[model samples]
Target: MTTSVIAATALDPRTMAAKGAIELRQVRKTYGDVVAVDGLDLSIKPGEFVTLLGPSGSGKTTTMMMVAGFEDHTSGSVLIDGRPVDSLPPRERNLGVVFQNYALFPHMSARENVEFALRMRKVPKAESRERAEAALDRVGLAGLGGRRPRQLSGGQQQRVALARALVFNPAALLLDEPMAALDKRLREHMQEEIKTLQKSLGISVLFVTHDQDEAMAMSDRIVVMKDGRIMQSGPPEEVYNYPLTDWVASFLGDTNLIPATVLERDGNLAVVDLGSLGVGRVRDRGAQGEKYAVSIRPEHLKFRTAPVAENGGTGELTSSTNLGATIRHRLSVGGHDLQLRELSSDAEAPGRRAAGPVHVGWDADKAQLLVLEG
Candidate 1:
């Protein structure tokens, strides 16, 4: 049986009345002298899905906790719909939170677990029951409401947790690595489900995760953090394709960073000398200097039939690895090692391995000039 893809559709404006915009102005969180989050200024428009992405101790989770009112910020304010919510309790703020561990009550049935939030809000018992069932249905657990947490699968228990979070019609949702506990395939499936639910409900969401692929898949915008500070924030394509810093470039994915000297600048492009490899033009962001690093994604480099004009280089294939859909090749060019990825369908004539003299080149436009970092 073929599974049909679910496309996220825009919700009606009336249905999204409870959606709230969140803004953090100069938000700072510190434990003694060590800062957890430093002067974070972020704005999440109503119905927007924004992700805080970083490695451990990068302040992504600390920032989320501050927004959820579970942790206090050292300075600054958190505003929801232009109103300050820094002093409000988590329940009073009407924010839904789902943690990495699906914190469902093991003793309670799925429906009761979902209904607990509504009961806390003083919702009528009858109405709470109705809402709980509806929430379960929304999460594809319609008939599983009678099951306990242990009786359900990991993904199902997570759905119950999600149902509990959404049963009260929250203004915004806070997800802290919600898929981290699941296996790889289930994690990917749940990512799509959460994204679909967020979009369908037109609710603003602040998702926190260290997985770059998860952030890229589910977020409308991604905020990359490091050492309690934001390294970069932008649409996934923008942040991935045009990172603002060397750290951002290196952290996001695999890329070949080659040190080169700037030869000339023309408009938005700069000609850089890659020493023995030759000269190439790359996108320049007003970086002034003779020395810079050119970041080129592995997929951008290819085996050229002949020497191209400005961006061609001679390299020897030093290593090759098969990665199912693609072949990863490490090339030694002018004393610098560069990684190249070729489609598996376009594998070299030698079947498994292709290690020998290879003409490696990439289009000048595919490279970006970055300032050398310490």
Candidate 2:
């Protein structure tokens, strides 16, 4: 492989002690006629924990492997600290990679496994042992260093693999579904640990995962990908609360989508007619059109036991489910289906007494209007 170094600007003082920033420009990977990544552009600031999240067959994992030098890109560039390294070998790139499965050697003890990298790099025997012990201790396996991989539990083995990754102190750490194997409870605990470790060490982390909640909980920023392309990239709150498109809105969480149109605009609010619900006013900002989809979260709807005439809208209880603190009910409103989640102690389902029709209404500001995409 051939590599050429280009001059890069000096690092900022705040980011001087941490790993370098990474940049990918128009990066594409193709196998025969199939394209895994299509003109992907991403920038990761120094010491940032960025997650690449998407469904199966999205290009998240492929992009990460290219950064680790494990897979070659069909075109474009991969730069570290502003220096292009598309042609460099994996070892020369100074990257630490953690796979989903624990890739520890069966014959080597935990301490020996962590020490192997240092030994291969020609560190003195005494120095190797000291570094290995320190790494094991850092991962909470100080006393279990003598045990082999088979003797340790799955979580313990993962910790050993983590220790091994940190032993060499690479410039950046690449994790591919690192928490996929562990049970739900243990996975939560490890997520916190991993975030804390990344912050403390100030290492640049590129994490890939298919789990939406896990990505939202652990990452500082998320890059949502679909069909071999990036759909959106931003802070977790921004991506969750202010989605750029309707596809993003529906994928992130449970929402009640209602068909509506813009009635009129005044100041920052626009009044909308919610069909059979009522001629209720809604906030549409400035959009006015014939067809639109209004999105409201299920938890935002308010249900009441009053008559349909007394309440603002008409609703009929179609189904009910008990979810501990709240009772979830699916109400059919004319042609649309709305989900109402209410505190059980606050109000019971309106159908118990044979009430012919119940009612529910939502605040105008709680609605989001999604226009037809081009």
What's the lDDT for all of these models?
A: 0.85, 0.77
Per-residue lDDT tens digits for candidate 2, residues 201-287, read 777889999988898998989999987899889998777765555666676666777766567667756655667655555545454
Highest lDDT: give the candidate number. 1
Error of 1 at 29 (Å): 0.7
Clashes of 1: 0
Local error of candidate 2 at residue 243 (angstroms): 1.3
- 341: Cα error in model 2, Å: 3.7
Against the true structure, whose TM-score is highest? Answer: 1
Task: Residues 60-106, candidate 1: write the lDDT tens digits.
Answer: 99999999999999999999889999889989998889998978888
Cα RMSD of predicted structure 1: 2.6
